[model samples]
Target chain A: MSPTGNRADWADDEDFDDPSVLPPQEVITNKDGTKTVISYRYNDDNKKVKVTRRIKTTVVREHVNPQVAERRKWEKFGLEKGHAAGPSFDTTSVGENIIFRPSVNWKANAKEAEKEGGEKGSMKDQLKDKKVKCRICSGEHFTARCPFKDTMAPVEEGTAAAPGVEAEEDAGGLGAGKSSYVPPHMRKGGAGGGEKMGGRFEKDDLATLRVTNVSELAEENELRDLFERFGRVTRVFLARDRETQRAKGFAFISYADRGDAALACEKVDGFGYRHLILRVEFAKRTT
Target chain B: MRPILLSGHERSLTQIKFNSDGDLLFSVSKDKIVCAWWSANGERLGTYNGHQGAVWTVDVSPNTILLATGSADNTVRLWNVKTGECVKVWEFSTAVKRVSFSPDGNRLLAVTEKRMGFNGTIAVLDISYGENLSAQAAEPTLTIVCEESKATVAGWSFLSKYIIAGHEDGSVSQYDPKSGDQLENVQIHEFDSQITDIQFAPDRLSFITASKDKSAKLLSSRNLAILKTYISDTPLNTASVTPKKEFVILGGGQAAMDVTTTSARQGKFEARFYHKVFEDECGRVRGHFGPLNTIDVHPAGTAYASGGEDGYVRVHHFDKSYFDFMYEVEREQARK
Candidate 1:
């Protein structure tokens, strides 16, 4: 109202005409709880209170489920299922190196196996396109005789320690990529053929026998009583040293004939004589 | 001769034998009762006592004064055959399984099973005294190991110069009496089981092994070579290589009346061959439904007896004609 005379003089006041009067200003409160003017027109405003923003602090908690240690984990579906680690619980999926290729591409709405009328797990179907491939060292050889199959596999052919595929990588060699292998029939057993029934017995006609025990050359009555049942015994000779007339630690019994001897051989070959094994054989025929 | 049921022991009869005259039969059993019976009339002549456990082996000396009995209790008790009294006792570490008299009748062969859990052992005692000192059961002259946990020295054969060892591994080993050298390890047919009984062929070159595997394997002592193999429907428990050197009789679980084979012969390439004498449809030796434990043809070849887990002693006659024996079997059936 500034001392406007009883009649407001409409004079051209230079200060009133200044545009700086509408300029913004700040109002701050003092420590004494008194309002203080921060700008040139602060004291002249109708309201002096200022607006301020407040800050707040908060906390939150979350729980995680128990997971097996990753280092000890192994992915096994069947044979190795009960093996070292727990079941597969993985964040990332591990898939076979399967690829989308020309051969894998099929006609739309087509079932290749169904087209052939073959079951999935059928032996014939399994053998349709797949040959007898070995599981190791993917070569034209059975796992048993694989040149690269050195140790650990049951039928390893070579005893000399061959470098493992992983070991070859460390050795920095031009390692061949492993694919699939061949089987025994595909590979030659010998120089050009295969093997058949026999181990050590292949050499001789004599069969593996059981000679249970050998006793002393005692009296004929005792000898006669024990052996007379199988067949008619032609001769019983207690093997003796020619010089000392002492028991040479054995005896020879001659059955009546070959059939009788064969039968006895079957019966007594491994029979125990006084905790010893009796060696039964066909005595060289004299007559 | 006809074999009548001479006598039966109340407890399981383990060993049976006849006196030289074949007049009296002596049987030692698990009941600790040693009974002497008159073979002619089934009369219990006398009873001897003192064995604490099952008597495993019994032998009669040629002189006839001594009746040596071996027991599972690990003691050899000498009894006067006539009096049926315990004359002497020889203590051992484990069960004394077999006892035999030397050909000379001067030394005693008492084969005992030591380390009861493992191997078969033999102890040969030198009793300088002929009939006076009780089986002079000396310190073991030789110790042989059969290696199997349940091995036992069953008997000494070949005139007491060699010891035969039976193994639970279905094998039999032999040792030279003088050298202690392991002469043989007979793989009785790879029986795949335990050997129930073994007997050395008298001539000492071969032996018979009856097994719990239902198969008997006769092995040659000379090379531990297998000479014969006998298959049966049930486990073969005991066998006797004939004193005639003619056959081997095997008795076992309800398989054969008992299977006997003819004498084995030496062949050109093979060790020896044996002939099948006869096979019986009935259970062997006419006894014991359970596992037959022991079978011995009287060293004299007159008759043999068998013992079994069923606790029965069964006696059989070899000389009985098939018809006469058949009549007897019929009579027994009629009685039943």
Candidate 2:
């Protein structure tokens, strides 16, 4: 069936069946002196497409010197002999627009613009007096790199246990008590749940199988084909070193159903591939 | 405003000049070719060929009938503007560094380099616009030898009364056009710094000099007295005075050899605009990737073009804001 709207002639219906042929373009002048052009072409999918465009033209007139006007008619010579009129793409191009406004205090305005662009400088100034006291031992370092991170809990655990008594103590010696840190899971009466870093993948954990002992030479496509015997695989993620681009002996394979995931884990745990035995199990949830 | 980029040269540009009518732009470069472009649309009109070495400078006659170029081939060649044909060639003992046409287009001056036991000299040739362009004088009418410091750039003063030349030792000297005798000499810039460019005002009463000392100075042509100074952060290669407005354009950056060691922002490759009377920088337009080698404003003062070491010529036409900017005192004077 012809999909174009308002076919004025019966001959237009016959052209739709023949994909190789296109109708001639039509141009119409409107009342406001605008032009409307309709043309037909074949798109990438080999389907016939019709394009309609409206264009307005304006003429700009400029007065130049008589000598300049005479020189404009000179012929191109040397390397550009007998070339087409107008600028060629290889020799001339329009650059990105630049906004230039003359001002009395241009240097001051430029400095302000630079300050706005480099936001890190202002942020450093705002954090000048702030200290980097660690949570483990109150050292001047990050909590993750602290020497006592693995051995001790946070230093203010007792104060967090008794908030009512600690409030009174905090009011008396505010500077001494640097125990204002709170975990995300314990904030706002502990009603809202904690937000995980990669929370979007939490729901897929049940149907995902963690595959370890993967050979460095094992490709993702080979692993997918090997695991496809048990179930329909939705995704396969292989961990690789950034520099060497070699597999890191670990991968994750997700299935459409939890039953298929369990079946694949049991069958693939003792399977041998690429001179290595694969060890597969259900993926554990990240804290 | 959007600039029109002309990429006709394959090597670093040495000089660029706009004709008196401000419709044609002539550019010479190290690529041994001279390209003439339409200033309005960036369309290349033609290329003048036949130079054996890198072209150093280019200038168009006031009548727009002849074009002259100096080159490292130790020769100066003139071309017919309409046909791009070499009309004549004048040979010298050393490479020609600069060339300029007189205000009335009746005389041409060429500055030759000092090399291989040859002292630097400024030679003036009489030009004729008769029916036969090639039947020109084979010898220079007069020659001025510089014993102390070589002349880098030279031009004629108003009414062709005095020939002003900028020296390699950062000094400017005025000489009698007929006698070839130095009338006055003054040190205008830092003592050992070389002057890179010298361009005259529309009336030729004064001129601006760009130097390696990171400053551009406007001086009176009659007595070589420094009138105004504009300080920049980078060594300037070229400076030009606008005709209809009270602004001067300065172009420069870090030296070309050190360009690869720094980023584009740190290189400071921009065309700076300064108020001629107030000596305050109004704004800057940045586009080139390397140091700017030359800059020329349109004779009508509506547009300007700059050539850089990156081998690109950018032509910019001013908008409303450029003409509307005025200081408080200037506005009050206009109101009166």
Candidate 3:
């Protein structure tokens, strides 16, 4: 059967033959020609949790039969999810607003649940056995004078808190993040960091960089020969245009050591390429 | 590979949960449907429909067939996993932000985000009485209220001993559900602006915190001490640590990593690919709008999935370097 109560095409041969086990839907019929509706449900295992059927039937409403006409109107009114009129069953006598068909629920009481969970169950379960609670906080264990709040370190003069810990930053106060550039914006923020140079990168450190261009240093053969002279050039970049693949103007060269970088910069700085002086320099330091 | 998109679009997807037992995937969407998919293979098993507004978050119980979803309609709907039907609905006032089931499935932690200029508190719902097909199992269930300013994030540990909560005050409090006493409550990580995510590490006592401070902080869940710090060039958008190794974190932001393009021969265009999401290869990638947004390393740590503002969550599996494999292959070719 389909999840939405429809049968799947692949499950064509699957049969739900036993109507005796079907969960029923509630229905109401009046003295006149109208009917009410109700619903029921079950899992794949076919255990019916609710049982009421709205098996529709119709009655005749005529000019002579005024009582039947009024009953039909009431029945139709009950068909609505919440209607004021319905059949003659006294709901007040039932003692409950709704009634449910019963099933086997294993844990009927705290005692039963507690038994299922032996002595070593969990701290939450253990505390409930005894009615001991923190009178001040009115909570489980720790009180208003919780020991952690009162750490052993002696107080200092000019700090809201002791060293190494500042205070919590209220995130909800900051409000939701809004940026036009990105629609779905969710960021990860650090907590409990009191240090001034905190966050991710410190003030002395750099945070952003951009590659302006990537151009060829030489023709393929000559470039190969020059790079082979070094211990090993794992990566070489001849920057190119984003739309067009032609060289942009410069590239990055990675070598095994700083010595290789210095050698390449010294030797290839002014080397003639297509009779044009190639520009080469050690990459500048970043923030 | 094409991911199986939910039937309805336009509505945003709020949260995703995996039922490891059946390897089924459950997703709550704004469309008000809880979709279940086979985890081992992507097959749409069922669609659970209920709730008036967007279904915001979905969580799975450990070993049982229970699925809970919170919606913007201000209600929590619990579903019987085997059947695509809602078994119960837990009502709330404001919108429910996060919903977590205790590891034992006997307790359901529903954290309703309180929004006001200067107030925050959480409402706890006990699931011991809220189990199975029997309404006859109604015992005295109580709603515990913990007074605070604002809770930005909330969850229960896998063990369910404590309710881990993050407040707008930049503080994290672990409270006992039964007694409602605040056990270990402190500002785990403080940021200049906001905390984007607070995660409990699998080991329990240790956890990771990410923030707009352009950094991620790892701390001890017991005392909430700073364990190690990971700095990013740009503010981190999303951060998640792997299940095995705590150090291996999967994250993506606008960190502009070093860009390098191979030489384009006479006519060949250089494949100038920008590094969007990367670990510390050479140096950390830096900047938002510079590279990546969402990233998830595989549980095995050998591969990863990254989704960026660029609009794709790509899966990358690491392969041994072909150059290393070909070293001997080249010698054999020379022998011939």
Output the number of the TM-score-best candidate. 2
Q: What is the C-alpha interface RMSD of model 1?
A: 38.7
Cα displacement (angstroms), candidate 3, residue B236, comes to 3.6
Off by over 4 Å in 3: A1-287, B1-9, B116-119, B128-131, B134-147, B245-247, B250-336
* Real A-B contacts recovered, model 3: 0.00
Q: Write the per-residue lDDT of candidate 2 for residues B148-215, one digit (tens) a residue.
A: 99999999999999999999999999999999999999999999789999999999999999999999
Evaluated on chain A only, model 3 obtains a TM-score of 0.24
Q: For residues A126-198, write the lDDT of model 2, one tens digit per residue.
A: 6887999754334588878765443332212422344544445444444444567644344443222222312
Q: Over the full model, what C-alpha lDDT does candidate 3 score relative to the true structure?
A: 0.48
Q: Which candidate do you rate higher for DockQ, 2 or 3?
A: 2
Q: After superposition, how far is residue B141 of candidate 1 from its true place, in Å?
A: 2.9
Using DockQ as the measure, the top candidate is: 2
Which regions of candidate 2 deviate over 4 angstroms?
A1-25, A40-42, A45-48, A112-126, A129-287, B258-264
> lDDT of each model, Cα atoms only?
0.53, 0.88, 0.48
- Proportion of native contacts present in model 2: 0.86
Task: Report the Cα lDDT for residue B327, model 3.
Answer: 28
Q: What TM-score does structure 2 among the candidates reach?
A: 0.71
| Model 1 C-alpha lDDT versus the unseen true structure | 0.53
Which tens-of-lDDT digit does each residue in A194-258 have in candidate 3?
Answer: 34424222321121111122234344345546554854664454444346655546544556565
The alpha-carbon deviation from the true structure for residue B161 of candidate 1, after best TM-score superposition, in angstroms, is 3.5
lDDT of 2 at B285: 98
